[model samples]
Target chain A: MRFLKECKADATADLVYRVCPMHLLEPRELIKDLKQGQVLEILTDYDGALEDIPAWCAKNGQEFLGVGEDEEEDFYKLYIRKLH
Target chain B: MKRVYLDHAAATPVRREVLEAMLPYFSEFYGNPAAVYDLGAEIKEVLEEQRTQVARLIGARREEIVFTSSGAEANNLAIKGAALANQKKGRHLIVSAIEHHSVLNAARYLEKFHDFEVTFLPVDQYGLVDPQRLQKFLTPATVLVSIQHGSNEIGTIQNLAELAVVCRTQGVLFHTDAVATVGQVPVEVQTLPVDLLSLSGPALGAPKGVGALYFRDKLRLVPQIHGGIQENGRRGGTENVPAIVGLGQAAALVQGELDAKARHLSRLRDLLVAGLQERVPQVLYTGHPVQRLPGHASFCVEGIEGEALLFMLSRQGIYANTGSACASKALKTSPVLTALGIAPDVAQGSVVFTLSQDNQEDDVHYLLEQLPPAVERLRSFSPVWRKKMAAVAGA
Candidate 1:
């Protein structure tokens, strides 16, 4: 898994306490609103998102920008750059 | 026997317009809102429309409303949901002592299992939570405060704006259970300054089993009911389309009629209060005289039990409540009355009358006529009444 010191995104989808598939479903919907090359951040507490999001990015042809460190350590902040 | 129903706070008859609006959804439009097909898409649109209607009634954005099973569930979501999600900020919570059992119990659950400290805030004799007193309870660890907008049992409306502002200035979240106030009065969140609010469909002439919570935009809540992506992942379960449609229709109808309805209800309420005071001795009017719900009148009659008074009044074809329907059946002194510092004996006689638009002036007159004699008859059989009379005679 790639890690980044700092990353900025055009939009953020906060799915911190929401259930599993929502970690996948909401970002797919939210990323549609972003233009190519703009980064989208997904905040989630679900551990599975660490692997699923990276794989989903590869399958969907989007660039995975790696996870950014959160100071509180409560949730993961994963970033993706829309490639299409 | 003349029948008069004065228990709107316990339940209300669904309005005709609301029932009609809900009929088609039960069969013809019975499609899951989560499916990918056109049928599901159509049902999804209908659900969002209802969300919009419920949101507009409270001056909140459509996205801010999350539908739930009942007002109790909404309270659970607002209290437990918000608190759990924000626990990192603090493990402390505060709620008024006179809140509905739903709010009180939810807080207790957190304190018992989640290692949180909860403060059961006290209220004045009139059931008013003083804003200054609330401010003093705030700590750096305080995360949320839940106070009901109006009391279904006592007819008192909290000065929510003042209380909410205290929390706001301190950067703490504030929630109000508005089940008793939503359709009865104008409750625009834009002016109220609360972060969360709960409202029930039954209180506004919609069918029971449907309610909604309003959380400010971007507020995070841990889901109380775990399931798939329903209610935008805030609450889960197949949408109750028929009841939600009913709630929407009732909300729209009440929004237009609220002013006239409040005026009609208050007129009857004043008549009943005046008549009851004139004909009955040793009656104590409960809650605030002017700051209460417009259609609610509550009293404690000395020398009689409210349950027995209810039975006698029921025989006369009048339906009323001694307190909240749940607490009244327990046959114990109401915690609400006890919190207000009423003597246990006096609180035993607590009676509440909640009026709705359907009730007419004649209904109030009938209750006034039947209630005094009902109390008198109940007191005549009571040893307590004799003791009070003997003390009066000695004096």
Candidate 2:
């Protein structure tokens, strides 16, 4: 579970992790909990993350870097770098 | 001084006779029914008597009765237990979309967690399941058909007896969650032809934490809540004796007054329903209108949200509900209404009023009087209602 910054600069690796879907937490709650300049690595078993995460970040003025999806287990890996 | 309790579907207070029957069990003869001692045998005799009493209320053999922790458990046991036990025969199930969540969620779990195929048959505008639709969905792979006898939200009564006959002829297991309709209505399992029926105690004026499942014949049921040799090893764990006794007593009382009480409730229910409809505008009546539970008055106030109406009524000391479809903490719009083809506008604004034997005509009239003003206050805030009012005035 190494962050992108935590990895050795000389090494290239991708980390696979599993996280529970924050479906119970409304987006308003999620937006309030996040802060500026903090990197959020979320693991969610939510299929709609590709659309939901990016749309949510865009509405909240957060940067949506990339998304990883898992169809088998119905999960998602979303990377967000808070800009403001 | 006007107060109301229009949520009889949620619960009822224990009847005097029921409470009296339970008093001795607590103090006088507090012996385990399963023990071999003489006192225990006496307690066992009374328990068996209760078993027959409860069984007779539903026209089932005493041996078919097995008490459980709650109505929810009884439903789970009947639906899931039957499905799993008969999996070798088939892995498919059928049920009404308007079924209580206890049955609906159990079926959903079977589909999600297991390899069972589930077909949720749709209901009509009044929350009645069409027999033709159910018949069309039944296949050789269909192992069980689960439906609720009466809806807790809208109060529509399903034709379970007819549906049960359908399942019987087709060689599929039938389970009806009769939590809302049991005791209040004449439930004859033998005449009804249902294979399994679920009963809960709270609705019949007994305490919570007790219910029972009735299996008509010698059908195999895999134990759902397992651990001990209790409940014939079908539903394991120590018995909730006090509640069970209370439930038995309640059943006896219900059996004694079944016809008369039903008529009484219907009279009061109609009075409330008619008074409210005549007074309140844009009111949409729910359920089967006639074939519904004897005590329910379900309607949608055109403009006000169900939650808002419930909250306002609570403030007035008028305890009713948007009914059992309300979700955790923040309420959810009724799945039953949605399943019954109610538009979102009506479904979200729905309110359920379940009367009891105690409710009177004066109470119903006063409630009718109180409702118009409250509804007016809420309707004033609704954008749609406001716009419509403005347009009508201009016209």
Best by lDDT: 1
Q: How much is B246 displaced in model 2, in angstroms?
A: 1.1
Per-residue lDDT tens digits of candidate 2, residues B9-76?
77678777777878887878888876789988888778778778789889888879999888899999
DockQ of each: 0.79, 0.01
Deviation (Å) of B15 in candidate 2: 1.3
lDDT of 1 by residue, A1-84 (tens): 889899988999999898888999999999999999999999999999999999999999999999997686799999999999
Provide the interface RMSD of candidate 2 in angstroms, 1 decimal place: 17.7
The pairs that clash in candidate 1 are none
Cα lDDT tens digits, model 2, A11-54, are 11111111112332333344455566655655544455567777
Mark the regions of model 1 whose C-alpha exceeds 4 Å error after superposition: none
Show model 2 residue runs off by greater than 4 Å.
A1-84, B325-329, B391-395
Estimated TM-score for each candidate: 0.99, 0.80
Q: For model 1, what is the alpha-carbon lDDT of residue B184? A: 94
Lowest-sum lDDT 10-residue window in model 1 chain B: B364-373
